[model samples]
Target chain A: MQKSLLIDPGKCTGCLQCELACSYDNEGVFNPAKSRIKVFNFHDQGRFVPYTCTQCDEAWCLHACPVEAITVDRASGAKVVADDICVGCKVCTIACPFGTVNYNQSTGKVMKCDLCGGDPECAKACPTGAITYVDADWTGLERMRTWAAKTDAGQRATA
Target chain B: MKYVIAGAGPAGVIAAETLRKADPEGSVLMIGDEPEPPYARMAIPYLLAGDIGEKGTYLRKSKNHYKDLRIDYLQDRVKKVSAKQREIVLDGGGRRAFDALLIATGATPIKPRVPGLDLPGVHHCWTLADARAIAKRAKKGADVVLMGAGFIGCIILESLLSRGVTLTVVEMAERMVPRMMNDKAAAMLKRWCAAKGVAVKTGTKVTKIEKSGRGLTVHLDRGKPVAASLVVVAAGVKSNVGFLDGSGVKVKQGVVVDDRLQSSAPGIFAAGDVAEGPDFSGGWSVHAIQPTAADHGRIAALNMAGHPARYKGSLAMNVLDTAGLISASFGRWDGVKGGDFAEAADKAAYRYIRLAFDGDRLIGALALGLTDHVGVIRGLIQTGVALGDWKQKLMSDPHRVMDAYLARAYA
Candidate 1:
């Protein structure tokens, strides 16, 4: 089974360590502007959502690309863009629903999270354990177990 | 069957690929005048900014991509098309026959009849070769004078700024991107550029170019002469339809194509900037943008391969990033006569949104520094959804386009 990056937005403290780690690991810089993962601040709601490419199954960015610049890494199930092939059309940036894919004006290519080739730097750098890498099949098991633990005789329900 | 495509830009390259997939056994021959591989003209700006190398401009990455598809690529210019003979006459007296033909010769920049245009240190930001020539002189702190404030000119300006050059822009129009943007939006752009230390001279024209000491003196109408080490000419581009003089193909501003992308001549089609196809507004017009070219190319190729596909029409849309400020124009952004409209702007924050309507139908939109609602405007205009109560709601506040779109589209 493939692994998935499970995110708990509630546990996120908005330290932006994931962003710093992501930028340094990939671009060799500490600039959050170049980081693939972004933490959107919702000031009124007092919440921060750590967001990146979901590596969607039927990726619109891959399909909308005039040239097959974006492809899937079967091992990690991460959608990756080939800088050599991208013509910097910026069409993929618009096609991505979550707007995770963005144009790198410096490189003239689109960039997105590639799951760090299965060992995500964001997950390791997350100080609050807000982000974690787990089996893709059971990303909700922890939450389900916690809810079950609160009910009745303390016997957890099999979910 | 042989498929002959002229022009090796985005439309031609894509047409060849689609032809191969549509007809696995069909032989594809694509002709281009450039020595390099098929490349996108849009990437030239990035190339000038040093973001990507020359090879990055290529539409297809692998050199063997066409070879692997069994598509034949040739470097030559089509001098004339003999529709009756179903063949084309090439430069240097070469001839080739085709079962069907596609014209994607794209466009060429209009060279003004001014002296010293052929001088050194003057270039047009169109081809990769031109970008190379520009990179040689557009160094940090180098004084540069750019002509024109049209769409292409603004794009080149952004890239030139990235090179850290001292820049001055001269435009004949009163504002930037006059053809695509409204006066208000254009004013915002002009102010934004000026705030970024760009010397924007709208309503100014370049009268003459003279060689000066160690640089060039660009004479402007009603202004002092501007001195610069480099001059970039982005006046405009004209369709590459001059070769079709006696081809019996109907030509206006470009090679006029029908709904199927077929030219006046049977078995001959035109795509990309060279094609004046159906427009959403009315009659025939050329969008000339990358998205339109890709769409037209695919439709033309599918029809060539015996697939019956109908193209609705090309919509007039332009999205521009002028030195960190994003601006977009959709559909009839200028607004149709007697069309109902709504607009709101915050000049201090540089945020603006104007919506046009033809009886509650979202027909057009213009926006600057207002993202997040771009998709909603596009969806509403493209789908032609009737905005019953939302029309009045939007008129009250155009920024609530997403609210209107979600409420009406989903409900």
Candidate 2:
């Protein structure tokens, strides 16, 4: 079965380990600025939210790409930007509604989450279990279980 | 089924691929006049700017992409279409019969009515061949005079500047990108370009070009003639529907296609810049942008493959980065008839926002120096979600568009 990265922002510790791992694996660097995944610190909410490409079914970046450089990695179901094919026109950068695809000035090509070809580095490097590689079809299983436990009569009586 | 696609640009290429996926047994033929493989015209500026190589402009890197897919490729221009005959005549004096025909011929650069445009140093920077010619002459410190500062011209400004050329922009419009931006926003963009060391002359027209010493002199209607080693014309483009003159296809500013992208003639369809398809703001318009082209390709291809798909409409949006300043306009940015608009501008900070609303739905937006979370503006307009009370909140604080989008769109 295909796997996808499921992120739970509440468990994120703002450590940016996922960013470091992403950059190191994909970019061969430890710079968070070069990472595919980003940990946003909400100072007002005092929360850390790790975000990256959600790999939408009808990806705007994939369609907006005039050169067809962005393609789906069938193994991970992730839309990956082929560096060799990309021409760095920055069309996909604006096309992505989530603002995940970014232009790399140093390389003159666009970069986005590739899901590490299959084994995502961000999922493995998450210290707080905030990001996990789970079955794509059942991403909301945990959230449903949490709500289901709250609705359970026995649990309500014990509380 | 025999499928023939005119213009092997992005739209044609994607449509062909999508058709191949759905109809594996159908015969696909794509025709383009260019010598090279199908390439993105949008990437030509990057090639001119030295950001990417010539090979990088191709739509697909693999040389056998089309070949492997069994899609026949032809390097011949389409001369005319005989819709009644279900065939198209090629410039090479060849004719091909088609069960279905897609007119994705895109647009051609509009040549300004001026003399000496045929001179060696003068060119239209619209095609890859044009980029190559411009690159050779637009060397460091070369005196280059660019005519027009419209959307197409502005896109090439930074690329021209990146070559270290002494550039001067002459526009007939009142300001830069007049069609896409309001007077205030256009004025701000002009200032930003001027600060980037570009000589911008708005409300000016190039009257003539005369040969000079290893260069040329461009005569303007308002100012003194400027000396230039090269003259690059970015005036505008007209839809490439010349072949459709007697093909029974309805024509406006572009080929008039219906909600299904089919033309007046049966079995004939249009897409990309050539097709004046449905508009998001409630009409038909030719949104010549790349996103619209791609969208049209997929939707038209699905219909061609016997999958009925209704195109909602193409949104008219443009996000431009002039030098370093980012400016964007979406939908009816100038505000519709009897529509309400809220605006805020910090001229000193080079930041501006103008949100237009029709009733309770956000319809359009104009933004400058607000790149972060700008996509939300598109989301709000495209979704057409009723803002209700949040409309008032957005009017008071235009910067809270992201918050408004999340709340309203999800709610």
Candidate 3:
């Protein structure tokens, strides 16, 4: 089964645990600036939304890469960027519609979510289950079940 | 039934120790997101002031103490928790199934979305990293523009003033600590700030912030741009509840916990800044303080171990030391509309005291400066003692009246 990442904004208190986990795994530092997952806080509305690259199938960054450095990992279905092969050209950062791909000044390379080789750290680190790894095919199953449970089965039975 | 607690903050560490005493056989596995052990949140301002070092803020017993208690401490964050499986997923792709779980994640400072907030020298005072950033940016003679004149901002002012750093306090409210103090008490504090050479711009709003040649320029609503080398935005903090989304836990402002600190989810409890429990003083309010957080940890641990306990609420008390001026307030200061008020002021000494009463019962009291009678007033507010015949004497000489109350309570 293809695993997908699920995010619930309501349970998010903007703790940045996922950010810390992501940065620690990738960069060996607990820096939010370098995290693959970012928690954005809408202060007035009192909401925190953790956003990341959705790992698009028809990736824009893949097509935009002039050096053919971006490749697809079959095992995880993640768009993995080869740092050694790729030149520090920022075209992929601009080409992405969601702007998830970012240029790292320190490494002189572009970085995006690689799903941590199928076991995403952000999903694992999220204490509130704001971020979760579930079956990709059943991403909308939970919401569907909720709406299905609310159906007027009794009324239909009476009719 | 060993327990694993994530986050070695005030709530986490306190629960670990409390649990050790309650259940000797139950070993504790503590994971700290930060490298440092538990430290007092109130002492961070003192550390910034150079009155204390980073070591001075440490609140844990000692390195040997954790070993003695048989706790396996790991300085790492918990990656995930499976409530059904009762297992905690670690960041290193490891899992530890537990009998119970406690999440005392605490809070993080709210960084405003204003432009140039991420620029160099723009800092916050929530964490050790933030404090270090501010300290690194601060110079001996640099001007510091502090946004928000709340409790944290004012405490930072006290810290910065000791270092001889020029300060410009920008507050949106007309008075400082509007929620904590009355108008009269705020006025006294304002005067004290002025006397100490701190430029307080109350009712001032910062609309724009920009980098201006090795410093930041704060453009306010009412005045010209104030240039400063460092900007410490002590706006406030929100509970670190973001990770609990989709976890089947109820969250509102904070993690919705019962009097036992248990969330809607079974076996998962939240405490400290992240958990909002019952506030007994008011109508089901949430108390956010170090003592309350500690209390929540104790109560939660007992219940987590199948030993029932209930949290009896917390006092909303705050003592602030700003540029050597001491201000402490407790309980509700705003009396019912048109309630009787007894006030006395000594402008020369920068001292003022006001007792708001709703007929014989004392509702709130505000005392500023070196008011030696504060101890007595605080006791009256805490114990809910009737003024009785001393009501008339309180209007004339509050010190004598407070003494009588103290004498009565002691008797």
> In terms of TM-score, which candidate is strongest?
2
Q: How many backbone clashes does candidate 1 have?
A: 0
Tens-digit lDDT track for model 1 on B310-341? 66677677667788777777788778888988
Top model number, lDDT: 2
Task: Pull out the clashing pairs in model 3.
Answer: A11-B245, A12-B242, A13-B241, A13-B242, A124-B79, A125-B79, A128-B243, A128-B244
Per-prediction DockQ comes to 0.07, 0.19, 0.01
**Which tens-of-lDDT digit does each residue in B1-411 have in candidate 2?**
999999898889988988898789999999999898899988888788887798888888788999999999999999999988999999999999998899999999999889999999999998899998999999999999999898888989989999999999999988889888998898888888888899999999999999988899999999799999999999999999888888888999998988778888878888899999989788889989998888787777777778777777877888776776778888888787898888999998899999999987888889888765565566667667689888998889887776675455431
Instruction: Specify the poorest-scoring 10-residue window by lDDT in model 3 chain B.
Output: B370-379
Candidate 2: the clashing residue pairs are none
**Candidate 1 vs candidate 2: which has greater lDDT?**
2
Model 1 TM-score relative to the real fold = 0.80
Model 3 chain A poorest ten-residue lDDT run: A150-159
What local lDDT score does residue B341 receive in model 3, on the 0 to 100 scale?
70
Give the TM-score of chain A, superposed on the true chain A, for all candidates in the order listed.
0.85, 0.86, 0.86
List the lowest-lDDT window of 10 residues for candidate 2 chain B.
Answer: B402-411
Model 3, B87-196: lDDT tens per residue?
87777677887887888888878877777788788888877777888788776888998998887888788878877888889888999988778777787888889898
Please give each candidate's TM-score.
Answer: 0.80, 0.90, 0.68
User: Residue A144 deviation, candidate 1, in Å?
Assistant: 31
